[model samples]
Target: MASSTKPPPVEALKPITSVSASPPRLLPTALSLPPKWLNMYSSFITANQSSVTQIESALRSLTYIIPGRFRDAELASESLHSSIQLLSMYHDTLLTRAISKLPGMPNASLHNRYTKFWIAKSKFYRRIATMLTMIQYTELLWEMMAKRKGERVRWRIIVILELVKAVCRLCLLRITNSRPLVTPALPERETIPEEEAPTEEEEVEMEEEVTPRVKEYKMKRTGLSLPTLPNPSDISSYLLSKVLTADDIKAPNTLLNKVNGSAQLAEILHIIQPVIYAIAMSRSKDKKDWQPWLLGLSIEYAARQLRKDGLRTTALEREQWGKRGWAMGWWAMRGAFYENVTKGFLQSTSERLPSLVSGVLDDYKYLWDEYYFSTSSN
Candidate 1:
């Protein structure tokens, strides 16, 4: 006779709140804040919900914690560090570890759970993207403040900034990059095959190994430049850290084993276009074509993705993005961030930058006009 024994008891998942029992030891200072802000964050942390509700609460609190102009460098830095630490913990526990254990298709209930989990994960990534952008702005603010104050800032700020960069790495690592808005987690090319399908285990394993990492920074230094002539690497590092550090450029692609399609890479270039232009204008005589190469290689990859997924078929994809118009806004935002940063930094660059950037802005507006009208009429 067949056995009637039940399967082993399933273990309960750990609470998301419990995942980060303590703040990071390396944080510049403990995450203390003014009484009011501390109270707000305390309430957010104690809440029992495990979904986007907590995310919303944290966002609201974060807005207040990050001051309008970043005064009280120590306090602001601590608050930002604390807030990101909590957000990162929430990401690791609720989305990365817990939700992934749910069953996939076969069972309707479990399948729905998995689908919802993915949606939640995607939303969380969007939030992280905003926070990531804000962190870059914080770095900018620090530089501006130091310049205005005419004194070197504290070393504590450096500790905090480095930690925040680490946080960027962590956020990128834990999230999915199969689409845009969700930055690509790695920097390698991807290829998908029509035949010899991967097993579920294999797919899971591959996704876990996902990486299209951002490694574009030229130096490790930060804040106002010293009076001494800075090295070339310093300039590259300063430029990259001012806005984005390859987050938008990084994509994890499976089609043809690459993450960036040409448009997607173009999207990255477009975002970094300002930086490339700045670097080029600063060193116009250096004729190396990596920036264009970056765009060209991505173009080739995009073609491969298109040919593999659409070219052989009768149905053409209407999406202009790397995948089904998924990352369109995010890709656009990368360009926007570059524009915003470049425009601001112009005060320190070539005197003509202001006019040049304004012209670029006009061209951007015109280019997007067609996209806007076309999409709206559709």
Candidate 2:
């Protein structure tokens, strides 16, 4: 006891009550990982990639098939037409098939990109094809017979524009499938009794009020006979008619009489009405929407085709001054649409967005500067 007392006092350990230890830190629970959608995405990319390669090949084949020199002397007219059309059909079928293989909406943004690429690329081909056949290009024009140094027995670049028409309809189809609830049900028609029908005098007077004779072309299709997807002619007459707008439809035809193409106005509706309806349906509940911008692009595409110096436009374009009013209207819509696209593209992070925006503007440059401006008043 004495020895223990004599020993130097070591520092005493803290009492259990005084000693404090921190609680052990917990490592976060391992997060569950999301499923990789690699396989599905791979299929989509592969389909598009293969299609691109095929398009390139088709272009090359056409270059070979179409003689480099516009040899009116050597080539037979019937044979040349046969070759051009046959090759065209082959290429068209391939492209359509390729486009059809594209994966749909699961990764819709990507799907839209490829589909849009096909549309633009198809247009580029049209420009080239048209250039080949125009009067301006001395090299591209071949003789139909000895006397005529005309372009080949051509339907406008029927192949490419047909593809565009397909895409427009496809877009409309998508809009329909979007199933927006905005479309109002058809209002029930109030049928007048036979006794209450308009008098012969009134009917005669009403008929007399009509000034210009309009030949109406009603486009009809059979549902039972409807071909498999990417049908040749969904918007068959898009290139044939002017782009219809919301304002055009809302106003009574009496007011629209000033425009020459009033008879064809329904054609405009047939083409654009479905598109507008689709846009309304496809837009999200959120305030921000791109439907108008999308429509602007459509307006530009349709109107540009109308003005193009190619087969499609060449066939449809007439010298009538009245027909021009619709072109001007399309221009206004295009300007508005371009503004929206410009804004959206500026804000977009996607790599392809800028190019698509610029590509459209670049292709249409001569349109605004040389064509539209020259046409517009000072």
Candidate 3:
């Protein structure tokens, strides 16, 4: 009996508790992939990469279409103009159609698709540069003819004026539409009303008293966030005015000696205001954020248009100036919104967090150098 009893006390398999084999080690869930369309679009941008060469070709091809070019006589002025008008219309229509069809709040895939479509469309309209050049040229011709009453023909001038208007519209549309959606910000405006009347003694007293109070209030309330979608109509109006009225497009450095004394200030202001608005809108939470990327794009585009003579500064200088303008704009925006731009830049690109603060400061410094030194030197 004693021998038969405790047969090695059979190690009581204590209910095998600790998840027998660690609960079947779960394999990681695969990340959800972007749709196929998006992959295709990204591949397209990579394949048909934009470069200085494409930009140069775009500008040169368009220059060929200019009305008064040295070798443009193969076609009649009317014929060339018609050809340009048709090409412009076609490209404009294509862009408009593509934009209208784009889905809102598109995922990364959709963004890639849109980008690819735009790049491809841009290639198709390598002729646009010519159209814009011609438009600018036509406007100049019309203005010159206006000054020379002896050279003006009423009917022909009417036709040319219409063409100019048409071209200007196209230019405005292209610029405004080409811009990816920007975030919206508050327009500059006066919140307080001025009194219609005040006594001389009271005015002096009010100036001393009310001015400080108002200034303090303004300083306190100076900053604000912007909206996402600005009215495209508003941007169009601003762009149209600049394209038609820029003195460089009308005549050259003659305005350098004029009333304001800044040769391109008006044009700069015109371009800057909308660009600022675009940046604000790009920072908006509701839409796809594009301000930072758009800033980079705008700077690159400006660089493409610039060239150097024997001057110490080159087109790179101009591009650098554009970036400086962007940095200044962001600095102003921080003040305008009553929020810190550095903080905003940090928050915007937070996923790339480690270098965020220093990066913005570096950008600010680089831009300042470009604006104050390079642009002035050029």
Instruction: State which candidate has the highest TM-score.
Output: 1
Off by over 4 Å in 2: 1-85, 94-378
C-alpha RMSD by candidate, in order: 27.9, 29.1, 28.6
Which model scores highest in lDDT?
1
Ranking by TM-score: 1, 3, 2
How many clashes does each candidate structure show, in the order listed? 23, 1, 11
TM-score for each of the candidates: 0.28, 0.19, 0.19
**What tens digits encode model 2's per-residue C-alpha lDDT throughout 144-206?**
232243222221222232334434433432333321111011111111112348989999999
- Looking at candidate 3, the ten consecutive residues that score lowest on lDDT are 182-191
Order of all candidates by lDDT, from best down to worst? 1, 3, 2
lDDT of each: 0.40, 0.36, 0.37
In model 1, which regions exceed 4 Å deviation?
1-52, 55-82, 104-274, 277-378
**Pairing residues by index, what is the TM-score of model 3?**
0.19
